[model samples]
Target chain A: MRYERPTTLKAAAQMLAKEKGQAFILAGGTDLLVRLRTGFIEPDLIVDIKSINGSKTIQKTATGFKIGSAVSGAELGEHAALKKAWPGVVEAANLIGSKQVQGRCTMTGNLCNASPAADSVPALVAAAAKVVIVGPKGKRTVAAEEIPVGPGKTSLKKGEIIESIVLPKRPPKSGDAYLRFIPRTEMDIAVVGVGVSLTLDGKGVVTKARVALGAVAPTVRLVPAAAKALIGTKMDKAALDALAAACSAACSPIDDKRGTRDFRIKVAGVLARRAAVIARKRAGGK
Target chain B: MSGITVNAKINGDPVEFICEADETLLDVLRNRLGLTGAKEGCSTGDCGACSVTVDGRLTCSCLVLGAEIEGHNIGTIEGMAHGEELHPLQKKFIEHAALQCGVCTPGFLIAAKSLLDKNPDPTETEIRFGLAGNLCRCTGYDKIVRAVQDTAKEMRKTNSRKGA
Candidate 1:
């Protein structure tokens, strides 16, 4: 396979525009190389983005944090500001694969891969993250929830590559948590992943909430009904149960080698409830 | 395929090598430099048998391209020893009998080196988490943990002596 390591974003975009669909963007290459060797992808050219000088930065901006698409999971987990503002994002990044995999896996790559089992997607979606894409058409941003169209499919057009991920400023008295259920802890795909973010009023009632699920559908799903169930509620056991039920109802899982549809649906509810409890605690709820 | 020249410090030695565009860091370490310490058990990065320290970060060499290490410093198991004596972790691994088949020993040694470099005194649980990437199917990990703990003590003793 041919490889091109562009040192600048413009050069990389220009190369992608020139090669079009024949070139694949390489960041980390933890997932891409595996797919390539396994015959899952046969791109004629690989555009290496590691050489791009500015693609590995994590900076705090007016809009919160701009995480470069090429930032490794280890870097994300170790980022001081990221850990303080969005601890769930750090937790989710840390849960991907293993230490070796985390050393090379990128958050943008995880989202671009569009795997239902990707650990980072639920957290990003729950955080209402936005993705910056650069191509021959210039730069555009899209909501994280709208980025993936289906399993292993994205809305990104040809020649476009994810530039960075933009997270909104962390709201006061709000916290997020991401939890995934896998048969074995490390190096296994998620059976059911849940991410929940809740903002609480002084009265301990949830003012706003967001819930996202992964590995239980064709793509990571945002459960609006589940979020609505928690809004204005005091996050009691009954309310949490209702939210979990809503999350389970929202999931449309298929029976696969990893788990049965029934098991996934059941665990989706369990994980959703667990994540909500953690988020509630983080939000300083009683 | 394009040809790339990678210039980096490998095991405290400055080296330059020409690598194929598709070549991974693991390939260069093993095939070109003959540093076979980083074994390729699973090129997919799951096995962690090809773990190495790249610029003070523990990473799977198989997942990184050779060209990606332009000016980075890398440490393999070969770097864990001094002139006439082995590193504390290496000596402790032998004293603690942390290996059976020895296939996973190199990866374990490198991983232990990384963990100790980052945190000189890691708890058993921390050691387990730090070495979670490296898999050892032979030894049940009890001996490995013991080896690391014992090496930490040895290192502390050596440091204290130097301080004295």
Candidate 2:
């Protein structure tokens, strides 16, 4: 295997373009190294992005926060501004692996890995996050939902690498929550993951809602039907039940070692309902 | 394969080594520098036997490459003691009988050191969460937790005495 550490974005893009899909970008190596050791990925070249300047920063912009692709999960969890603006996103990023794994796992690696079980994907989808992609030609931004095409697949063309993730500024009285069902408490893959975000008007009614589910489909799924259940309601028990049912109906899970299909589907509904309730409480709902 | 030179401060010493492309931090630490305190139980991140402090963060040495350690500071279990005197946590572990088979002792020690460094007064739950990554099959963890609590008391006493 060949290793290249480029210090600049342009140099990294040139290297990526030259190697095309044969090159894999190494962020924290929490996932990539394990995959490489297990022969899951056989990239001819490895591009180390840690040396790339300005790729490990998290900054606030006029619109929202810009999370650099190489920002570690631990860093995301500890950022005070991110915790206040998008707590669910921080929670999802924190759930990626154990403390050791979080120390090295990057949000970009989690997203680009494109696993349906990736913890951060559902939260990013719920937050309406945008992915910034850079390549030899130039840079472009795409919706998080549009980035992943299937399991372990992405719409990124050859030589394209994710640069950052952008989350829009959250309005007041808006909150988000993410929860996942795993066999063990920590250091286990998600059987099902749910992210819920709601915006409440002054009268304590949900005006806007976003619900996303993970590990229940080919990719992280945004259930519009579930969100619709809370669009004009007060997030009452009946509304939460309706949203739960919609989320369960929208999922297409498969039986695997982590959990059975029936169990995953059931837990998906439960997590979605719980997340919605927590998010509602966060949004100042009674 | 191009030879990459990794320069870092390891255990309070400036260390430099030439490593191969696929060489992990564990490999460089064990084979090149002969710092065998960090054990390799499961090469994967599941087993925290290879835990090390990289720039004040607990990380699995097996998951990191040697080239990633440029300009970083690493602290292995070897850095815990000062000359012939053992660190307080190490002394407390012995007093509280925190080990039996001793295979997982180094990893546990490093992990416990990390916890105490971060939160000097960690509760039992906090300690459990802090050391959750490191696994110990022997002693059932009751004694280990007691040892950490005892170590915290001892450290606090030492600090108060110095202040006085």
Candidate 2's C-alpha runs over 4 A off are none
lDDT for residue A16 in candidate 2, whole number 0-100? 81
TM-score of chain A of 1: 0.97
Chain B structural similarity (TM-score) per candidate: 0.95, 0.95
TM-score of each: 0.97, 0.97
Q: Whole-model lDDT, candidate 1?
A: 0.88
Q: Write out the backbone clash pairs for model 2.
A: none
Q: Each candidate: how many clashes?
A: 0, 0
Lowest summed lDDT across 10 adjacent residues in model 2 chain B is found at B127-136
Q: Write the per-residue lDDT of candidate 1 for residues B61-163, one digit (tens) a residue.
A: 9888787788999988888789788888888889999998887888888888878877888998899988888888988899999999999888988888999
